[model samples]
Target: MTSPFDPTPLPPPECPAHASGGAPEPEVSEIGPGGLRRLYGPAHEKDPMGLYEKLRAEHGPVAPVLLNGDVPAWLVLGHSENLHMTRTPSLYSRDSRRWRMLQDGSLDMTNPLAPIFAYQPVCVFADGAEHERQRGAVTDSIARIDHRGVRRFINRFSNRLVNDFCESGQADLVSQFAEHLPMMVMCQIIGMPEEYDEELVQAAREMLKGSEKAIAANEHVMGALYRLVARRRAEPEEDFATWLVEHPAQFTDDEAAHHLRLVLIAAYETTANLIANVLRMVLTDPRFRAQLSGGHMTLPEAVEQTLWDEPPFTTILGRWAAGDSELGGQKIKAGDALIVGIAPANVDPVVRPEPSASMQGNRAHLAFSGGPHECPGQDIGRAIADTGVDALLMRLPDIQLSVEEDELRWRSTLMSRHLIELPVSFAPRPPQEITGPVIPERAGAAARDWQISSPRRPDPAASGTVPQPGPVPAAPRTAPPAATVPAQRRGSAPVRAWRTLVTWWRGY
Candidate 1:
């Protein structure tokens, strides 16, 4: 049995073009220095859309680009072209084994991009009947989820996360809220213990960054998934993991584990970034905020607009040419790799002539990609973002960005672009009392007594300033004493701290 992580190259799977003859060499002009552009670098990281515009101007919709390690591939930049590539799976394949570089052994498991493109047993890397089997299991399992229960979990986790910083009057929304909310909710849905979330979050994020640690991070995530699958198999539960294990597809332990890994990382990364992006737009753009708060634009509409303008995933490592074809006036050969330029395609001039115009109610954006391989968990991602953002805003209506818009930083990679921090300030508030089980019983097992750390009380003596009359000062007001939790329920250090803060809040 070969290890999935085996560094040894395997023989390229045979394709129609390979049987007819060898794939044609790309035209010299197209492969030349002037024709090819590298897709990862400071230039691209700083201004990917600007760089996409230049590439579109020079190379039309299907531009030749080099990924990390100077590996060559094509980037599909036109909206129509992107749809054509993804929709016509007969002409393009999702299987990375068909990739020319992978076939020739020029690309290997060690490449930073390998974490994305390396072949896995999961549906994302399958095609034909195999794809249908794996994808059906995922879709069926996802469809079984109770969305209302999902929203409850989202609300509960959102409140808990906000409580960690509400009393401080200042917090980094990225670190404190956006990053943790999605995974925490997902843990409940997937039947994983909440204690594993912090480690999973760190590993999932590191895996997507295409860094030297990406492979290791990916293994860590998979190892955890394997353990979860084993537990579920031994004693099944009514959660996503158990569903996959018992699906009619009869997935092996390895297959079930890989698919769980797929759903977890994909959902966590996309939703986390979506939450961050939506919040950033609300804080930075007064007009956008007015529309939402004024009831002119719904939160879902704002999320849609963000998807079009700044998708969570800027690019997805992507379809391989099934045979010779032409797209966006560029000739493609069998086995040529083509990345889906999601963000660029959403703004393609052909479909969206005025990129600045609103994208309300338009679900055509490729933010979630399209075709048979489109994201199965997109609705879940949207639900998490919408419910989480709405909860935060409702709890902290006075929230405002603590730093200037220009000062906010972003981390970009081949697959994603996300905020590094979203520092914000708001009137200090007390923690919401958890009156009932945060996790509804129907949402799997009864809620665990997970404890969260108490937020720091602002130091009034350190400020030493005269109070302003127009608005409340940054210093937190004295909170009331919190009720004590039963000793048996005081689970973790964080929760112990939270109880102390809650007790203090009750005295205010």
Candidate 2:
């Protein structure tokens, strides 16, 4: 028997002679535990849609599968079935504590995949009245954000990131651009100093990878949030942290911090992946680019299409059977784990008859999930991705993939699929000069209270220079010297290849 984590691709299943002779095939139950397909492994990672189709043919919509430890779970595949499972919270609970494997110690807490499924005291794990309280706090606090101001931040940060690479003529969009833009914008929204953006991004990525470092990385993230919550308590600011702290639910300091961490990580991971996916599509698909350039399709439409086709998260872990119940014709016992197959359901033939056809203008994808636990901050993620992608394209209209599409690679975990690197080449250009205030004036006094810090200008009096009243002349545009560009910004093929290998080996 092959190991679940085996990198070797499995051969396609052959039709039995009995099937050609009109004999009935074996039932899924008779296949036994050992015969169940593993959700991990290189074959699934390379082509998950193929795996989903095979499972659908063999075991119907809710297929029995093994997780990392050969731990049994059900993967819900049908679009409607996924909706049914998520919508009926009474029948299927989000509380991981209710999972039977955890109860029986069959699922080791130290398992690499455990970090993702481990129960925490945040809104994501709560159900019923407790869920309402926590979810309300999160939603209400997010509602207080000025979205127009968010777009401004997205544009400013997007340009700043592009400026870093626009002078190099070659860049890896994944590491250099897509990865950092979301967190930088998020820092402004959460009232954290922009300088801490890199640390937060690193911590969030490490925590989600479910590697050995996940636990320590999670603690590091929580520690940052705890400090932020403490600061907000004394000095209330117009930010998500402050609003969450002031919610009527009156979360304890720890509870507030956990919720803040939840928002930060969720927004960061989804948006970062979304931006990368959209950029990859634009760079690789001539049809997509033509449509956008010709005004036949808009960037938001392209974003929506990517959400349907290549959602950031592939499989989410997961809802548990609240009691003995039936789902997609499967007998789900109390405490049985059921993972939501987000990517599979999106291409489900029942809803998407032509899977290869365009998904433009469709908003029914399970990318952000559905029902009571649906992502409350999905709109914010969309805004960041859409605005950020548009800004990059506007700045580098000639950008194209530096390698063949087939040469591109991805790193897949049970929970998400990530583009490892997206190398692209374009003509080097001068950086755009930003001339306005960082925060829009319409943001009001609350916005002014927590201004994004910037470098202090030298005082004329201290410099012993008298100011001239005439307007300063605009600087002449010139290509930045190659020596001035950062080594990583140059996007050296050998360096990028080594980095990609390290990232893949790390399971990120």
lDDT of 2 at 274: 94
Number of the top-ranking candidate, with TM-score as the measure: 2
Question: Residue by residue across 1-508, what tens digits does model 1's lDDT show?
Answer: 1111122232233533123246763322212243466787677778788888988998789888877655678899999999998999989999989987677775666565676887888899888999998998899778767664456557667888888889999999998899899888887788775435577778777777655566788888778788889988887665778777867777999999888888988898999999999999888876576665444676778888999988999999999999988888888888888999999999899899999988888999999999999999999999889878866876776788898999989887888888999998888989886444655453234323221112221233555431221221122233422334322223343445544543342222
lDDT of 2 by residue, 61-173 (tens): 88888776456789999999999999999999999999877776655554557777889998889899999989988887777665544665576678888888899899999
Supply the TM-score for candidate 1. Answer: 0.80
Over 4 Å off in model 2, which ranges?
1-33, 437-508
The Cα local distance difference test for each model comes to: 0.75, 0.75
TM-score of each: 0.80, 0.81
